[model samples]
Target: MGIDLLTIHWIYLIFILLIIVFMICKKDTSLICILGIFVLGVVGTSDFSVAVMGVFNSFVFATEELMGTILIISVITGMSNILLISGINETMIYPFTKIIRTPSLAYWIIGILMMILSWFFWPSPAVALMGAVLLPIALKVGLPRIGVAMAMNLFGHGIALASDLIIQGAPKITADAAGIPVSDVVSASIPLNIVMGVVTTITAFYFLRKDMKNGTLFEEERAVEDIEDKDCIEKNKYKFSKGTRIFFAIVIPLFFAADIVIMYIKKLQGGDATALIGGTACFVLVMISVLTYREKGLEKITSHLIEGFQFGFKIFGAVIPIAAFFYLGDAAFGQIFGEVLPANSQGIVNDIGIALAKAVPINQGVAAITLTTVGAITGLDGSGFSGISLAGSIAKLFSMALGSGIATLTALGQIAAIWVGGGTIVPWAVIPVAAICGIDAFELARRNMKPVLIGLIVTTIVGMFLI
Candidate 1:
């Protein structure tokens, strides 16, 4: 495992170049990241046999590590879809619109509401709920599709998912790697989340205002885009009962409450948080199916599970290749791949981080800003969490080389990645929002571009000075 300086890692450089060029050419970041990993393995070993094994090994480890979390997310998401189809989700959101009276209020209200729901239930479920009920009201009140999408993105994915204060998934993952307390990560992330949230939200507002002033578009018409009920066929498939609605109203909260209580009890005894949540979600999935389809319990349960798996695989598959590439940088994964290399080996991503750390001599404050920018760039792939470990690793390197504040730098990077890559500012990420609002995802993204960009810049600057 001796570090070798003499051997030129040409393949590594070429692979990274290809990825950058592809990204520049507007190729999918997921594909480029995957190819980066494949090249990393092939170059590192110079043996097809070993390279093939490395790829498989990396995937196995990555899949195993992410499996529980992914499955939990999928099942809960499917349950949310069920809730929407049953109109329970809409009923839950119906009252909020009554309190929200104006476009501005709608924006903040929707944003904050999504943040709250996503904190416990996650963004995917939160999206379904918000889209079904709150969206229609917001649309009715002249909240633009861009505005609604921005609100959901900021609250659900950006603030809620990034902080992960309740679910603790994102923090747990980062804290485990950093060897820090989950509480520390959570505490640090809260303020950073606020910075990003405020910046993104305000930026979105600014863009909206600019467009409104220019008369380029009308805010009222944003939500007036075609409302296709094709996706709502499920609404007709299942009849909603007042009883069932009440049942769901009680059961959904109860299930989540039970999850929290169980998680707390387990944590008191130092148990696994992810496993607790995952197991609870699985149970909820099963119970919901039984309660909803009491007559054909087994068949209906199988159907729900199938649907859950479909969603799980769709999310997981989209990023598996990306994860595979990032996996190469972690020592745990390197060991799994049986790569007898030092942790600091010049893999494409690592090399870039190391080179930046060495060449850019700067103060801790500026270092933090630089790190955050790098994190944001990496997040362009649209999976915020995918880049956390990389950001963490890079922050550590920068801290060592440039005397940057380690915790502060890491926090900055984490926020940057989760905010941008987590889905708030990206068009590809607004798919569910577009699907629900009956608008083009590209247009939603375009509308968001200015505000999100401004917010990210503001947040990064603030993080540097304050963090």
Candidate 2:
């Protein structure tokens, strides 16, 4: 497991430099990752032939690993997009406006709704739906666009997508790496998620309320200020056919409940649960598209799939290279690249990580914090999945080296990765919500920064104890 010092120093230096440049310049991570792979491959293999293959191999591995998640995410998003065009998303939220009579109530109400929908449908689509429907109502009732964006980001992206309780994708990643059941990861993560969610939400509310009070100077004018998304309001006036409403309302929940029950009964965990969820999502996607489109189902099906792929690729294209570099820190992929280098040299990337851990000798507390910090940083690239992949790999490496619970470590890492990069803390991730609400993404992220940082710190501490 020991790495040659000569290779370690050079590889480590190069990785650090690339990372610094990436952070400072805000360049595309994919290019940075490709460069890392090429450099590492050349150094490791010392053969032009192997170095060339290494680049192709990096992309191949990323495609192989992420293709399914990307497909499911894209298709589901596309389906939701179709639902939006049909005004089903608006129909779904109209009822909430009545119950949520005030701005405060709207904040929590939208947060919970976004959380639920996000768990099933994901944040990208959920945000679109929420933005199209709830945002105007929220603003009308005195909720700032910033507040609306913050709620969607925290609830949909941070709480729901991070947990991915219904979909099981995030849990599967951690569970697979830990060689544990998905159920165990799910069960453990729920409590952690609740703690994180409540703390973050309350903290956010406090800050938001104060801002609202201070900004009261323009209360009358702002109150009259229309969000200009009059088109969404017009769309909501259309009534959903009773059958469509009744069918989806009952069917969606029932499908998810069945999955939960089946998973519990079978004690299914990891890939089993993920396959079950993925399979169910695909079935539902097909059935729903068929039911809505009817005789034209074939073409509609193709359209939905195409939409899904476009959305998925848009997300994946941005994050894949970062994943490739992080994979270097793992023995599995690292060993593949390491073989290309000096025959006698050990995997430099893996070795350097271990050596640094040993050299600094961080305690479990500090290690947890470090892991969380690293996950948050990677999320800056804006695709939560890439950050999760990188964080999971790091967790596996550290857990093995430290003889800790990989499941716990991976879950902790997943939380940090998603919460930060998943959308709340990143301007790019908040763009949809911001654009839809006619607000600024940077301001949205800045508004969310404090709550998210606090939540991360608290969660990291809790993870140390739980793990």
Candidate 3:
């Protein structure tokens, strides 16, 4: 079956290349993306007015598709914020502090908790809160501040943020772009994520131990007396009673645990799973606001929710335009423009994949490596997310050409992009963790580069076999 290419297809290809170049150069792509959308519209409609309207319509469609993700992240962040204010977070982390009698225990436990907390509330809030409570304990038990920062950055933003297992945020974006079910991406990512996580963490730990034992790590290092976050460290602001804080701390975990149980029993993944978590967080937020704020509970809940939504939009504002442009590569193209594509044209991306498959020499190894490289390049902008949609779209194209391995390719790109730019090895992205630990952000990134690269190499090879 021969597939014919159109002008729109060529236009799409050119813009994708341009966007990739922008990302590799660490340039902003919003204007470029908008221009791409408008040009695509102009080409499709051949009418300036309709094309302008199509740009606006595309934004709306992208927002609509992403609303579920936005809501869940916002509500969960709201819940975490409330937990911080009420001082319930202190109780939640207090238990882990007791078990860090050894340096190894301190390293692994802090990282594991960081990964779990990151899954629920994203990395920023977790780092801010956890660094306050656990940083001191970890340091006391012999872990250097840099090592502590590495654990948090790697596990929280690197491992958890990349996979986004329970929240399904990353998977949702990539899957939507790749034109596959979110569950398929999730399932495919599991083994790959585990391999990457294990290899990276263990290798990091080995180097950490060797460095610590050699005393070279502390050669010029000064002792950090305190962190910069005054509110988290010096201030003990608790609005609720100690007993009430303890109660909610226990109840909140139980509720989330129950949500996990329900997810397993009901087979809920992706949006369904997200709905359960979001609903639970909402109830917990309302309940705590009422109990702690009493008469002001209603107003306070609104404030907290506003804060959460602000964080959500701040993180996703750039994502919307990029997503809008990519959505056009899928079915949204027809719905947005009312059949602008030619008859017998299997969607633009699908056709490209088929066309390229016939035109190029593609195998599992080449596809796997290409995805890793593309994913890494996309992540160069420091958002990690700014380019995953591109990775997904490329995965879809390559999958068609190779006749298999879309999920593997998608997961590989996701891991590479995120580990590099999702606050792990990127100098700017590592600042939050570095500040919390009082270490240089660039140094932290340098330390992380070796382990992350080693992990990516091993995982890419593993993906080759699976594909």
In order of TM-score, best first, we have 3, 2, 1
Q: Estimate each model's TM-score.
A: 0.82, 0.85, 0.96
Candidates' C-alpha lDDT: 0.66, 0.71, 0.87
Q: Candidate 1 vs candidate 2: which has greater TM-score?
A: 2
Clashing pairs in 3: none
Residue-by-residue lDDT tens digits, candidate 2, 257-369: 89889989997765566677777766766776676667876887788778788878987776566655665554435545654335444444445546666766656786687
What does candidate 1's lDDT look like per residue over 71-100, in tens digits? 666666666656666667766676677988
The lowest-lDDT stretch of 10 consecutive residues in candidate 2 is 217-226
Regions more than 4 Å wrong, model 2: 1-13, 171-188, 215-240, 334-358
Clashing residue pairs in candidate 2 are: 44-340, 44-341, 45-340, 45-341, 74-308, 182-269, 182-270
Best by TM-score: 3
On the 0 to 100 scale, the lDDT of residue 232 in model 1 is 70
Single out the weakest 10-residue window by summed lDDT for candidate 3: 230-239
